[model samples]
Target: MQETGVKLSREIVTALVEDATAAPSMHNAQPWKFLFRPSDSVFQVYADLDRAMPHADPTTRALHLGCAAALFNLRVAAAHAGWEPVTRLLPDPADPRLLAEVALAGATAPENDLAPLYPAIHRRHTSRQPFTDEEIPRAVKDALSGAALIEGARLVFPDAWHVQTVLDLVGDAEGRDATEPAAAEELRNWTRVGAGAADAARDGVPDYAFGPRGRHGSAPVRDFAGQQSVPGRGTAVFEGTPQLAVLGTPGDRPKDWLRAGQAMERVLLQATLDGLATSLTSQALERPELRWTVRDPQSAMGFAQMVLRLGYGPSGPGTPRRPVDEVLDIE
Candidate 1:
């Protein structure tokens, strides 16, 4: 019998990879690759440097975070399939390209507690529409924060003045991006406008996922659709006061990103489970100067991984993903 599990097989690898692909990417780039070593029943995730956005993620920080998010999803799927995944991040320093290795081992049924989140995996999306004005209950906030904590990250909700300050910084970042030709060009290249050949391109934000255009008042969320000119979008007022939360870690490193990504997905999934919508804007964080301002002055959190806005509103439409076969390599 195989030592990994009572039911170890390559078929489980396929299912796990399929679920991992559902994770969110910067522009649905899905800039990740997975190799399954059936001999040891181990799966390795690799960053596809070819699909990386040179300007937005020159350091591959965002790319790493995105892939890590998928890695979390992979574990969730594996657990659901009644296997325990043992993951090691950046397993080989010499192999900088290798993101992680997840081997299916141990015969364990999915934890009763974890079973619920698996369902939320398919339901979560990056909702860009304005959330309702109603404030989220404190209990819900606590739960979401706890989810982040469980994954080795901190979730801090800013006060009113802090939230306003972050918003201003976001505005500043937008203005800079508007003036910087390179940044604007990068955004244009990745943002999808229509269902034309441009839209069919492998990487870039798609039209349907784009939020409606906003006036100068608020830093409008990236309009993947309008960025190109996709038709049939409805205009709606964005939430005047959004519940802003920051996911942070004590230090910034590749492993920190991996942990943060896992925390991020856990929080996002829990928020969805609670019927809340989330939209992430890393625009401010993209610019070094503006990114610093998003962090609360009171906390020792070193760097911010993501700026999440949560509230209630229309759920976003499902974004497309590359076929599993394109991402999974079994050997």
Candidate 2:
């Protein structure tokens, strides 16, 4: 390997890690760790098992997705900082928790196509609010699809029938959660409530980020508040026909899930750059049976990884993230 001698300054690494931690996770768990090896000039991404939600994400698939999103962000940040990031996913089979390793090297030009996405890393947020009925331009959709294809995944904008079926499945998942108290409990534990906690705490979804109650709409937005009512949380009517996209990979293994996550983030950042607000609803995909049903048999997409809502809406408030020092270790 040609040594590029890229100086991984502490300030630069901290900025990269900060962008990495901004990735949205299942319930804002942010279940990931970063280790920087100055000697080898490599950054290792690991799954934080302690932060994993066993009840909701039994297979740890969601955890892998979160870590991979962070990995994708790190690559973009590196490229923006004028370094080329060479990433290897699942670099060690013996250490399953180690999701990825990225080596940063000095670059004469921007690394790959990630430099354009650096600004989106900070701009993109999971907008839970209702979107307008305005359609996303075909050109923008094609670009988003291309972003996924570049990352070795497929992005499918389901037909009307398929969209309806996905919405029903999400409703079914919500119903199941209502009956099974344990499922909702797990989500509640990760949510930060009250002004003080939302302002001071790091990690997890804050109360302010929980958009208004779904008074009338079939959009698969998860009711983070659940049955608990926020004192002044108003109600709003969401778009009847939401612009939805399903991200998938050819396989359903852990590595495949990570790929889907990378694709998801890439598509999201591209969308952000193109002036689109997005939110994710994995409610239907959370359950194995529902996950399979959520897939469109007509489409070539294999395994559904995430359901994304994209449109012209208010960009969501930025959620809290743990300090870089807390999630990243230098050696």
Candidate 3:
């Protein structure tokens, strides 16, 4: 066998990992680890089981989704660094922990100008504030739909009636979760708010991202502030009616979750690039019954993986992230 002596430099590897870490994760858990083997020039993506949110994600679906989003970012970063990332998903059947393996092939220029999206990566966040009443233009919606399709997922924008149905279902999920001691306790542990020493803590959704206490007759937005003892974390009249998109896949499986996660980030980054504000509400999708209902009856789409709200409004404050050192592993 002939040996092709191609090598991946450490600097390019570090740059790619840095961009990967910027991808969003549920509650910013960043539940992933990357192992790079220079001998074969392969980067192995692994799920950090310790960071999994067991209560909300018993099957580790959400965690896999998050890691997959990071993996996508790694590919884009590699592309920008002049390398084509050749990816293998679920490379080992027996070892389910190994999510993917990316080999660094020779560089190939991105023909379609994916460079525009590279900027929105770190800029995107889960905006909880009610978006302005202004609706997103049809063109923008179509563009985002394309983004979802590219990542092997479908974006369903519910009409007025369907939108209301989704909101109601999410409201029910929020109310039930509020009263359920186990669910509420889990939320409390992951929600960090208030000032002083503890505020410096890493992980969990911060207080700034929490917009106002629960409002009456409003779109369902997760009120992390309400879960905290401290009250009054700013207020805003959330857009009375905002566009919602349901992201779904044809099948329900681990690979589907990863695809959904990548599609979610793709849509989000495109929205950010298009000068639109966005927020995600997975409360309804968190429950199995509610999840099935969120899927558009008209489409072949299965249970929805996420519900996203889009509009023109102020960008939410930046949420803290664990330094790259914490999430990225070098080997």
Whole-model alpha-carbon lDDT for candidate 1: 0.80
List residue ranges in candidate 3 displaced over 4 A.
1-11, 110-113, 197-199, 214-217
- Pairs of colliding residues, candidate 2: none
Best lDDT among the predictions, by candidate number: 2
Report the Cα lDDT for residue 54, model 1. Answer: 76
Q: What RMSD, rounded to one decimal, does every model reach?
A: 2.4, 1.2, 2.2
Per-residue CA lDDT of candidate 3, range 119-226, in tens?
888788777766777777888889899999998999989899999899899889988887888887777777777775236956777776676654543767777655
Off by over 4 Å in 2: 1-4, 108-111
lDDT of each: 0.80, 0.89, 0.79
TM-score of 2: 0.97
Candidate 1 lDDT score at position 11? 70
Candidate 1 C-alpha RMSD relative to the actual structure: 2.4
> The CA-based lDDT of model 2 is what?
0.89
Question: For residues 1-331, what per-residue lDDT tens digits would candidate 2 score against the true structure?
Answer: 3455666789988988998988889998989999998877899999999998877789999999989999999988988887888889999999999999999866726327889888899889999899999999888899899999999999989889999999999999989888888888898898877888788868889989999998998888988898776767889999999989999999999999899999999999999999999999898888998899988898888899999999998999999889899999999
Return the candidate ranking by lDDT, descending. 2, 1, 3
